[model samples]
Target chain A: MQYQATVTIEQKAGMLDPEGTTAKRALGHLGYEVSSVKTAKLYEIVLEAESADIAQQKVDEMCQKLIANPIVHNYTIELKELN
Target chain B: MKIAIIQFGGTNCDLDVLHVLKDVLGLDAETVWYKQEDLTGFDGVVVPGGFSYGDYLRAGAIAARTPIMDSVKKLAAEGKPVLGICNGFQVLTEARLLEGALTTNEYPKFRCHWTNLRVEAVDTPFTSKFKKGELIRMPIAHMEGKFYAEEKTLAELDEKEQVVFRYVDGNGKVMDSANPNGSLENIAGIVNTSRNILGLMPHPERASESILGSDDGLRVFESMADYITENF
Candidate 1:
């Protein structure tokens, strides 16, 4: 079986988001009804795991070692199993 | 007079920093790799600038956890002087040796140029060579230099005179537009609450030589020498 994990990283609140600000302003003028928006990096990984527990452990290691910087970006991981 | 400069893999400024300390200031300094666990008998420790771990997850994130930082933190806690420049500043903040965090520049570009800095306090060992309100020129090169801290923490730093340097204009006035990184209160450098650790975005070593334009940075290094002589 193969599992897919996705990780998203976002800037903390009150931290300036230059990229988000620019994007939000542009989206507003385009009539997208975007009030506030923040930018984040996304990573998706596919790996083989016998069980969900093992898959989660590998995903956690990936987040800690490479996917996200715990110091600034907080990450949320989503996992889906494919049989 | 032996100074230890921590050498992380991506630390580009370690050699230049050593040159400034040895050749410019005539001090004995050596580079210590990040894996070393001990930093004994060193007068001071410097964390030079570079994108450690290729700035992989975040600037200074990976390097902060290196074994060398444990000893650096201990030295800083003991009131020994530690200076972090550019990416080194980010490393210090990540290691919790200093307060606040650095985000990307407001311009969203990798800014590299000389900028004006006003010395906000001369009370700490880091800025003793300069008088309060003196304006100095230094080069800043970084994509993430905007410093952010909680409002209460910022207020406390102001009250304690720990906000050491701020970005300014040629007229010696601090203006938001002149703030290259949009740092809180235009902060460019600061000392820890204990006043032993200093972190700043500007490259003082780059300005130590007259040929580089201004030698104002020599004062910063010289000030450290003065502080060491006076105290130790």
Candidate 2:
């Protein structure tokens, strides 16, 4: 079976988010009243697995190995079986 | 003595490093591709600056996982000197060869300019030629050069005296204005716990020659050479 996985990587809370701060500051310069903005990277991957459980496990391994840095980033993984 | 300058696809500073090592320091240096799995016969290794893989997925993250890093790690474990500059510094952090991460600059800019640094410790092989508290100037060109580490990590590094260089004013005082990228504690360079590996945001190769402004960076290479002669 083919499974599609999406991983969202985000900076940990309390860590400095320069990209978010810059976006918020830029919005303020444009007269918007946004308090803040946070940025993240989303990765969509398709792979072969026996079941959704296996797919999820694979995606989790991917996240732990490369997609996220435990020191600065947190990641969430979503998996779906493809027909 | 032979040294290897690990070259990734987007590495632009490999030649600069070769020039400094071969021409300036009189050492035999060769550029090794990232795919080469073995790093035997090299007494030292340098991960030169440049956007590896176009800085994709985060600067240095992908490059750090390449096969060559395994050999680099093995060599580092053997107590061989390894130096990483600029983007190479990012790779070192991503490889977990060094602690901390280099995040985006506080102002989120790709700053390229000469900055003054104070030598914090001289006991390490990388800075043995530098006098304690010596101030020198070097160029830094990177967007994500702000070094960030947890409080505990910072404390441990401080306690171990592993910090090698700190951004400072010409007068050697670490002022906020002198910090180009808002690195924690103005740290510009640091050594591993073993002190054999060094990673720094500054480009020592760019300053090895007198005509390129200041020749202060030469001492770093000189120190490494002296270390190889005495220890290896």
Query: Largest DockQ belongs to which candidate?
Result: 2
- Candidate 1, chain B, TM-score (2 decimals): 0.98
Give i-RMS (Å) per prediction: 3.0, 0.9
Can you give the lDDT of residue B35 in candidate 1? Answer: 87
lDDT of each: 0.88, 0.93
Write one digit per residue (lDDT tens) for candidate 1, span A1-83.
79998888887665677888999989989989777889998888899998889999999997876566554567888899876
In the range B143-164, model 2's lDDT, one tens digit per residue, is 9999999999999999999999
The TM-score between candidate 1 and the true structure equals 0.86
Predicted model with the maximum lDDT: 2
Q: What is model 1's DockQ versus the real complex? A: 0.42
Model 2's DockQ score: 0.80
lDDT of 1 by residue, B1-232 (tens): 7789998989999999999999988898999999888998887888999988898778998998888899998877767789999999999988888888888897899999999999999988788889999999999999999988888889998999899989999989989978998898999999998898999999999999999998898888888877777766
Top TM-score prediction, candidate number:
2
Per-prediction TM-score, chain A only? Answer: 0.85, 0.93
